[model samples]
Target: MDERISCILSSLKKAKLTPKFRESEIIQLENIRSATMEDISSVHSTSYISSREQVMAEEAVLGHLEHDELIKDW
Candidate 1:
């Protein structure tokens, strides 16, 4: 999780406002494994999953993508 997001979640917990948040707002907190492999497979094609996993593995070793150039336009 990103530090900013972690801080936000911590603040929410401290405020005791989580239950007041709607289901959609809290969906991002659902555990990554909440979905079964079969369920994920249903949504993602086999090749797409393989390619994304490969990219993630490579990023883990090489570090995150440099977004400075991309963000300049935005």
Candidate 2:
């Protein structure tokens, strides 16, 4: 067996048992993918998203950003 798979199986065997995993755990995993663009827009204003995109683009071109400046804004 692959080392990774063996390690994972061993870990699983060692895990403490509890009540069986619930249906909610499955539902949460199914929604792990990102929300649609419309969903994102609904949460954040369109203008804010556009401005954030521009800032990220500029940072990519510059190759580095000022950490303190970014944290201060946050």
Candidate 3:
């Protein structure tokens, strides 16, 4: 995370990009959660129905659906 942030700041620091708005003008944004299998299946023929609930891991926060399991089943 540190390396990624450093790279972004270093790259953009010399880019001469103007700020769209000041930090004081920044607005809070709401986060929308991921879609469930039932909701997704309505749009497609197949959907990944996760067998277990999600859990947080060190590397990443696991989603409600297991993407790897879904790919394997596919």
Candidate 4:
């Protein structure tokens, strides 16, 4: 198993032993509804979605640039 995955599993195991989990305070979603773009726009304005998309695109570009720089350094 990947070190990161093992660490995450270990963390989850530890979390289950906490008082919050023991008391069943956390709500876990059993069934998830698959939402369409129309469903999304119904909740959020078109302009808000557009701005969020732009910010996400900018972040993706920056992440790639940072990754490329790291590779170059190596």
Candidate 5:
């Protein structure tokens, strides 16, 4: 995920879409707390998150299968 985010940032930089931030402005905080279920449920239902997870899992499996087919063709 970090690599993907870096790739996106690099692409944006190449396109001159993202403004360069100062080194001082880029703060990497440590030990950040994750949001609780109650906090998340305030905005989205647990069922909705579960459904989205299912969809993403299905898409990932389909993508893997497609990649495998392409490899076989090669």
Candidate 6:
């Protein structure tokens, strides 16, 4: 996922669409606490989260999951 984003960003740089996006590279938000169910609940309902998880899990094959939706249909 990171690689794909980086590739797109680099391509944008090559295209000169983003003048200093490469020079001003993105920095990861370090030392952030992992979100728990309670945190997620603040924004999403339990049923929706569960349904979303089931969909993602169902799509996982051989323990691998790709963000292919960005390029192809699910």
| RMSD to the hidden true structure, all candidates | 11.7, 15.8, 12.6, 12.2, 10.1, 8.1
Worst 10 residues of 3 by lDDT: 47-56
lDDT of 3 by residue, 19-69 (tens): 332346546568977887677768665322221221224224523344444
Clashing pairs in 5: none
Every model's TM-score:
0.39, 0.40, 0.24, 0.44, 0.37, 0.47
- Which candidate comes out best when scored by lDDT? 6
lDDT tens per residue, model 2, 1-74: 22453465456445622113333343334547767888889899989889767776876788764544432321
Clashes of each: 0, 0, 0, 0, 0, 0
Error of 2 at 51 (Å): 0.7
Error of 6 at 54 (Å): 0.3
Candidate 4 local accuracy as lDDT?
0.60
The runs of at least 3 residues in candidate 1 whose Cα sits more than 4 Å from the true structure, single-residue gaps closed, are 1-33, 65-74
Ranking by lDDT: 6, 4, 1, 5, 2, 3
Give the TM-score (vs. native) of candidate 1: 0.39
| Model 4 weakest lDDT span, ten residues long | 65-74
Q: Tell me the whole-model lDDT of each prediction, alpha carbons only.
A: 0.60, 0.55, 0.42, 0.60, 0.58, 0.63
Candidate 4 lDDT, tens digit per residue, 1-74? 22453476567667774334554664557889988889989999999889767765876866644433422322
lDDT of 6 by residue, 8-27 (tens): 85677678655344346545
Per-residue alpha-carbon lDDT of model 5 for 1-74, expressed as tens digits?
A: 22444486667667755434344555667999988878878999889878756765876866644433422322
Q: Which ranges of candidate 4 are over 4 A from the true structure?
A: 1-24, 64-74
How many backbone clashes are present in model 3?
Answer: 0
Residue 74, candidate 4: C-alpha displacement in angstroms: 32
Q: List where candidate 5 sits over 4 angstroms from the true fold.
A: 1-24, 56-74
Please give the distance, in angstroms, between residue 62's alpha carbon in candidate 1 and its true position after superposition: 1.3
Point out where model 3 deviates above 4 Å.
1-29, 47-74
| TM-score of candidate 3 to 2 decimals | 0.24
